[model samples]
Target: MIRRQREIDTPHISWPDKLAYSLPALSLAIIGIPVYVFLPKFYTDTIGLSMSTIGILLMAVRLFDAVTDPVIGYLSDRSAGRFGRRKPYIASGSVGLAISIIFLFKPPVLSGAMINIYFGFWLFALFFFWTLVAIPYESLGPEMTGDYHERTALFSMRDGFLIIGTLLAAGFPMLIDGIMNIMGKVATQRELFSFMAFIFAPLIVIFSFYCIYRIKEKYQQTGSDDLVKGFSAVLKNRPFLILISGYTISAVGSNLPATLILYYVEYVLKAQRAEGFLLIYFLTGIVFLPLWIVVSRKVGKKRAWIISMLINTGAFSGVFFLGPGDAMIYGVLVFFSGIGFGAGLALPSSIQADVIDYDQVLTGQRREGRYIGLWSIAKKLSAALGVGIGLVLLAKAGYQPNAEQPGSAVFMLRVLYALVPCICNILSIVIISFYPISEQAHAQIQREIGRL
Candidate 1:
């Protein structure tokens, strides 16, 4: 790895700087669960919006991100100031995100038309600032330290916190309502989210600022702002294309189970709920992250990643055959599948940073933001595809909510939830297996950049 003249010879990131970089991921992740899992229900049940209307608005807003994400990445790359390029966006966007959380979570009392208007406006604002903060914030990771193994450790810790934050957010509504009842007070969804707004808003701002104040951007950025040429070059980078494709495919696979877990448990496993399965899966991921990091160090990141994918997809594929009375079996399978979950999250991100380095080596430029933005698009696209396909297929199978599902619907549910993800994971593995940057290759890329 290259070192600046006045810089120390060490390539290791300090614990303080690593924590500063990783903690914001926790706060950012807190926003995801509430918005994705609870927000629609809140609007539909409490705020008087129809399910169809809420779905359209939510999907439209996400599609809107297709435009905003890359543009922000493009702008942030070109942005220059005393605080450096990414910091300006991170700091300012943090405030915007906080405000949007407040308004979006705590909607004002309104009638039919006014409610839709209020909902759409603030939802738009939230995602707008989310892209604003997320693109630049994620771009900072690759530049923090160029060491390959340390990069794994860094992202592992970051994603570990992300899972933790997600778990925390999952319980917020229930926790608040429970506490209210314990105190002999009634609670409403609006009031619950209002309390969450106060909690989450301050957290995002505090952590965003804390990270900005603590970490200094180390790698000197040298990149062009020409949108056409920059993106054209990004498209031409073969390794990046391969990595992003593989990641997107796997994300689509994983999203299936997340989208259909409830249906599968209720129908196939004859279960009342799936909160236990969800907990086992995510908790295992959080607890086992470091093991994958260690594995990556021993057997290179690429092989370790492929191994993790195999562990994940391989274990989960067995769920396709389980019938009613298989809850314990399902739990064991979920635990095995989750063993690779942390590696699945952290390794791709670490590999992405390396691919960006390869991009720099090719173009003599630092264009991490553009790559991050495109990667974000890949994720969004995968999610949209996953949800659309899973739900639509099941609906076609004659799904009726809260009723005994037809055999066709149950079959479709099992196929979509279990088999489809394995196939996607396998496809992802095939593509990612072809990625070119081994640890040695990335180190050489960094050395080449230093020569320039």
Candidate 2:
């Protein structure tokens, strides 16, 4: 037993190495915010595409992206070459990502239909390469460390950098626009998107190359040899199922607030501007990540995560009662709300790494890419579902964009923004309560794997 345990031990990764390894997350966040948050608006308002066409195009492409994740995951697991399993895809995908971003944001003059076609093709290409980069990249975390707490710490760095990336991505364009306003000049959204794409393209290249060269993949000699049986076994892993489901439910809760924040500030609070409060919300997540890490260390990851969810659930509940001119009160609520946000961002992926470890033992093979791929699918589906549900509710309540909505519409918007997420969080907390992999169970699983 001792000898078997010794056979699987991995070296401790230093803080600098973890940070360097996580730089790609920064670029990932930088790219993601623009695509999800801003691109639809850009296409509709700037490129002359109708909202309906843009909406359908986005839905089709994202569903296609979700479908392709597992295939990519299976291929990534089976891949072997001089560049190693993860890096070749990471390096090549970075290039594809850069080219696609440039073309998508900097298109030539085209009619609405032509623009939709253009966006669709490039968006598909972008998601394809994004899958290439993200799946294997995320798979590398658990492989970097064998210690459970270190996995949490590692992803804390990851989620921290992701928040920083989000802040930078969100802040830069707004900063640019603010500067233009002060100078009494107007810059179109196209130019802003073009500028961002140009700047981040090279940064993505630099970070991807840095990660590929600097962050070493721990060598694994055995992988699942049969694709059909392996994929089936992965689906059957009970912990993975629970983790993905709870995480998906949690993602819906997280996404609703994001999708509705502007509307909430604009209508419910009657605030002419609330970007400062939004920044406070995101910045708090980065700041509180270390504290959450400490909490996870003391209470265990699952418990810590539940506590965070409860905090968010309780904090968001107050927003349902807020009214016009409640901006200051809302800001305070967002500040407290962000503590949970930080923990939500950091803990789940680390917990996921632990589950991957459990799977490695059960199957006697490493299938991190496959697992992370399915996880990615859950996230995409949740975001899609959340947005769809929120919009349908708003539409049913007679909400109209840029027009004064009736009392019923405003009340419905508040409910969707505040109460719906609270309910999702409660449901997630309930689902996760049944998760069975405690620290002792994980250690036993490791011992069992070592014996194999």
Candidate 3:
């Protein structure tokens, strides 16, 4: 039997401290969901870019962005400073994110050739800044606590708050639009951008800074000349590699539906009122968030994750069998799928913390930043692929946004929306089943590390 770590000696951390520390990282998700879900729609619809062009642009930029994550992760692992290596990057990245977000939505007054240039700049800046904030922020969770169950609880808090962020990102655009329509005020695209910036950007900045100030790092940096060795060590961790691969694939499965749901509702369901339907979808997930967390704790993360994947796969697969005018039927499917997504959202990070412990036991160094950076890269890559896949399918099906979609186009849209994600998620279930870490195994690993 593997001797467990002595629990008595571990310093007790308050729940408030954990919440404060985790909140800033959670805010990044708020910013991220919008960037992923809305930005493509914004460019394709509002900015007048062709779907193919937007897809190619997003794929190219995100590939570039994905490649940079490991390098940033490696550098962050070696960094030591007064505010800490992670915090400096977090602060700098937040500023960059704020500026990039503004520029992404608020382009120049010029149109035609100049507009593409503005768009290109916005794309590059947004991807770059998002990396800086996201990589370091994700690294914080595993480093915050060593207790296996405590780590799960910490992630539960982070993910619970993250659901709120997801809801806000998913819901706010519709809410704003509805509010404007109610007041009999017609807000232009530019005005909507300005309004979102005015309302949320400040919250992003304020909460991010407060999170930085509140969360204290337990791991003090060791000054070592063997930084290259540290990078090599992190790369050699096999468990991390497996987890990242599974995570990337699963992320793609999850994001594909989200990226295309609006299009599906509008084009296939023939519903112009997509926002309400989407709100219902997101609300179901939000309501089930706590339930999923509780379920994860009880059944163990891997099993919980697999269960969610199965639910999502089943829900998505059901879409292919539904025809037009089945909006309410589809809506019911979405609500069930959202429960699966809630589990998907909550458990993975907890499992990630478990992986971090496994790495620490073997490597004798905490390289959470590097691990998280790579994980973020995989997720971003998956998202980029999802958008690209959606675009390619749209093009193949001859989808025309402002015009009537052909029967072939509508049929193809349903297949991509339902069948593709269903297949991907089925595969994800297989991948997650291979995830070796469990709650008991993780606790044992932490115990071993404590002895060392």
The model with the greatest lDDT is 1
- Candidate 2, poorest ten consecutive residues by summed lDDT: 1-10
**Clash count, one per candidate:** 0, 0, 1
Better of 2 and 3 by TM-score: 2
Model 1 misplaced stretches (Cα beyond 4 Å): 1-10, 219-221
- Model 1 earns a TM-score of 0.97
Determine the C-alpha RMSD for candidate 3 after optimal superposition of all C-alphas.
Answer: 4.1
- List model 1 lDDT by residue over 1-452, tens digit each: 22232221137888888888888899999988888888999999888889998989988998899999999988887766567778989998999999999998988889889999999999999999999889999998888877889889989999999999988898777789899999999887778888989999999999999998988875444455588888999999999999998899999999999899988999999976598888999999999999999999999998998998899887888999999999999999999998999998999999998888787778766788899999999998988899999999999999999899999999999999999999998999999989999878877887887676
- Which RMSD values do the candidates have, in order? 2.0, 2.7, 4.1
CA lDDT scores, all candidates in order: 0.88, 0.83, 0.73
lDDT of 2 by residue, 1-452 (tens): 11111234464678778987889999999998888888888887788888888777777878787777877777777777666777888899899999999998887899856777888899899888889888888887777877767778889898899988988888888788998899999888878988988998878789989988877776433464676777789889998889888899889988888887888889888996667877888888888999988998898999999999999888899999999988888899999899888789778998888888788777767788888888888888888888888888888999988998899989998898999899999999999999998877777876776577
Error of 2 at 320 (Å): 1.6
lDDT of 3 at 48: 77
Candidates arranged by TM-score, highest first: 1, 2, 3
Q: Which candidate is the best by TM-score?
A: 1
TM-score of each: 0.97, 0.94, 0.86
For model 3, name the residue pairs that clash. 5-447
Better of 1 and 3 by lDDT: 1
